[model samples]
Target: MKNRLMITAITLLTAMLLLAGCGGQESSNVASDESGNKTEKDSGKPKVAVVLKGLDQEYFKLAEKGAKQAFKDLGVDGTFLAATTQTETEKLINILEDLINEDPDALVVMPSTEAAIPVLERYREKDIPVILIDTDLKWDGKTTYIGTDNYTAGQEAGKFLAEKLSKGDEIAILEGVLGTDVNEQRVKGVEDVMKEKGIKITASQAADFDRVKAVTVMENILTANPNIKGIFTANDEMAIGALKAVKARNLNIPIIGIDGTSDVLESISKGEVTASVAQEPYDMAYKGVENALKVLKGETVEKSIDSSIEVITKENAGEKLEEVKSILDK
Candidate 1:
């Protein structure tokens, strides 16, 4: 009878232990579900890092704004970093490397130089998709480029200048930094059209995309050559600087520049500048983010996205001006 009683006690103990084990397992599963970190998507949204060439320039600031808007709309985590200046190639590359180390889901970059090609290639090897915005590098690793058709935009500016100038009129070119693809392509486009039209370019100089430097260069060009009748500045800031220089000379020189920045558009409306090739930077930003999300979803995006450009002159300045305002309004 004692053996029977002991057997019953042991069986009850075994059953209790098994039930406790099952309860513990159920609690563990509930805790795991509550903690919520099993999958990548379950943890949080993907991350993207946006790197710009510089933050000081108005152009770069606008690009950054676009990027921020894109991130917000896409509902992704994005961080923006900038090199202090366009000439800071090493710093820019370092920034890129640091961001890459974070293992961001994607990167959108505005490269300062072609040397960044290999660095970007590394990102591709790691299976991280990259998008180029505003400026481009010579790498196939990038999934898409979202910005102006810079070459065509330059050609349009050239054509506008050509139409405004008569035969053999002396025109001066204020180029951005040398060797960068954006500046090179823009300068080439202008020179190409100028070559086709048989126009004379009396002076050309690199202003390093600096407004003050552009002003100094324009002043020198004006002082050295009294015959300059027109100016082609690679960017709106430079064009405005040239306008200041021209106005200081008490002379009228037709100026055509790129970027329909609010100030540039205002200059166009005020007849201070002849025209500016307007780049839809905001739309570029919005689309870049939209496309990034699409890319994440395994949707195909175009290898290149030309945000489109337009000539904003006094004739259509009001409409162009309003278009930019509407973008801001949004």
Candidate 2:
């Protein structure tokens, strides 16, 4: 009887431990489900994946910061990532594929080129929402687009140049990658206006938007065309590089660029660059995430959100910069 009692106690203890383990497992699963459903309380917020062209550019870095702030305010996850090169078509495809598999509710991407439509279609096939920034694909698979008006911004830059110059001034253009819409549009806009005013382009070269490359290319162009009166760049990093080359040569040509980064604005204030076309990158990031959240909630939003642009010259650079700082503070 003693042996039988001891065996019975052992069996009861085993059963109690098994029950406790099962209870603990069930509780853990329940907690996970609860956490997942928190966004469903009233205004549901969805996750956003921000895939940029590359991390080396100051413009993209600021964009990521703005996206992070928006995510915090809306209580959603904003996963920020970048490709090694802006033109890495395969890398972007793979990143999007993995992100889609994880089932993030939405994606925001700066399309590497107009040629990335086929990959974007795959995401559309999976019913994953997409937001395009900085650049866009030709096809319309994306849920919405948020970016600067590149053509108009370029036009403003052109106007600034026209005002700064007299008739028949020779200018050189340092272009970004050719096929990308941002580069193409901005270049065309400037050329269209400059040509209308009879401003002749002595040299046009593609720096591929790389700063170091821009410096070398600018140096070579300076060797070939020492009489260039004005220089226009597609982005600020390249603009800075060109400025360095110009300063090294002690040339006093007016230089202008796009993407109003802090460094570029500072350069404008210090007369390193003549001007820049300022795009609302922060607004693009904040609104892109906000729109993604709305889409995941099954709400209808505009297919495109256009942020305005401005021409930042030395005259208004200080006031405009102060205004931007105030906006960022809020």
Candidate 3:
């Protein structure tokens, strides 16, 4: 009886082992997701992770909308993530490293700066495609960059600002974070155009892309140069902040910024802000994921994708605001 029981136990062990061995890669079976969309999660779907700069601002939130929409539309198991703030480089790297271990098939990153290059290289080494959005890194392994031409946007802004001011009229520039390629290019574009138009640049100072910081910096600039005629901020937040500073002193001036956030658009509509060079943050992130999926599927993608830019002024600011609100609603 004991011998019979041992034989039965041995047979059951063999059966269990064979059953375990039969399980191979996950199936790509179609399944109904919670949203009633057909998904491949039941089996295995491509896992793509998107690590954006931060979600602290509306611009990044718009980018987030794009990524999420792209993930659903493309049928990929997308992981959308971001650091709490753009300045949290270390935290962003940590998140990237953890994502690397999970071995996502593709990565879409809107890096804060070049600080993310080494970590991105790891994805390259693993043969995982890395797509950059918003901020472009110098690494050759990047599948592509999808964002606005910051310099061109700046040039447009410069031209716009110059149109209202006479030659030799002094204007101050509120630069974004120093050492950033975005800030540098945008600032350079404005400087070049302003120089071409014979407009005097009184001060170009970094506000670290912080609205409150912009207020402080603008206060200092206004104090130092009380006759500052106009202001051009690298982004809308800084523009709004500078506006606050200008308003506090009852000074009315043309203040143009790059990002066309709804707040900026509203301000423009109300004739509070002069204008904003609108960038498609949502489209940048949307294309970033779409192209990453293409790279995963052994398809060729362009090394660069310009989402497009627009100058939102008082005339169209109200219309643009409605359009923007409709997109975020989706």
Candidate 4:
């Protein structure tokens, strides 16, 4: 009878140990799923998906550099995607949909248009965190926004141009794509400041933020108002185009543009572009990824983060160029 009781106790102990081992394994599997699949805390590094507007532009290239740097620093897996053309909203939306299917731990996006907002909303519905970089959309579902305050940057550009031009001086405006928040706010800021300064806007036309389109638009404006004294372009790409148009006319005009791209800085150094409202594209992208990681880790993060902006002119273009070079080089 004693031997039989001892054997029964040993059998019960073995059964309990087996059950506990199974329970532990199940709990680990649940934990891994709760965190995004393939997360650093579970399997390997967390995967982040970044969808930019277009990769062909200089500004986006700088942003890409920043995103890559963040991946290296944070030890996260990153996949970057972009539309071939800046204005291809359909393509961008499709890319976003495919990324959603992949179900990455986080997403960073620069929406090309308001049309992309609904697609982003779907991500929110699925409980995936998103961070907006560079351009912004009308939606509030994003985890956070990481970019310069474009309206404020536009106001700065206006103030810079206002200082150089006299009241009632005829100036032309080379606008970006229609219906983009960045373009609209920047234009409004410029209009408000120009109105206050009594500066007359000779012409304002949408160039879709394309350099080639800007050249044609600038030529048309010059033809209509050959006496225009100044020009304000929504971005540096358009500014460069306008500069080319002005050069072709053998005219000297103070042209201010946003985005302190290397090409624009070179133009500033050469006294071609008067100044630019320099945006921290690299910082915006880097912080976008960093903030996404924080979201994944359940850490608190600010809803909005301004990467900061600056005014780059001939006086300080060289210094700004070096700073930009350092970011791109890294």
- Displacement of residue 190 (Cα, Å) in model 2 is 0.6
lDDT of 4 by residue, 65-105 (tens): 88877877888777777898779989999999977876778
**TM-score-based ranking:** 3, 4, 1, 2
Worst 10 residues of 2 by lDDT: 28-37
Worst 10 residues of 1 by lDDT: 28-37
Considering only N, C-alpha and C atoms within 3 Å, which residue pairs clash in candidate 2?
A: none
lDDT of each candidate versus the true structure: 0.83, 0.80, 0.88, 0.88
Preferred candidate (lDDT higher): 2 or 3: 3
Please give the lDDT score at residue 313 for candidate 4.
Answer: 89
What does candidate 2 score on TM? Answer: 0.83
**Which candidate leads in TM-score?**
3
Candidate 2 lDDT by residue in tens digits, 1-330: 999999999999999999998877654222111123323212344657778777777677677667777777888755666787776767877777666765667888888786667767877887888889777567778898889878887888888888878789888899998878899898999999898999988888999988899999999999998888899999888899999999999889899999887777888999889999988777788888888888888999887778888888888788767756655452
TM-score, structure 3 vs. true: 0.87
Q: Rank the candidates by lDDT, best first.
A: 3, 4, 1, 2
Error of 4 at 257 (Å): 0.2
User: For residue 149, what is the lDDT in candidate 1?
Assistant: 78
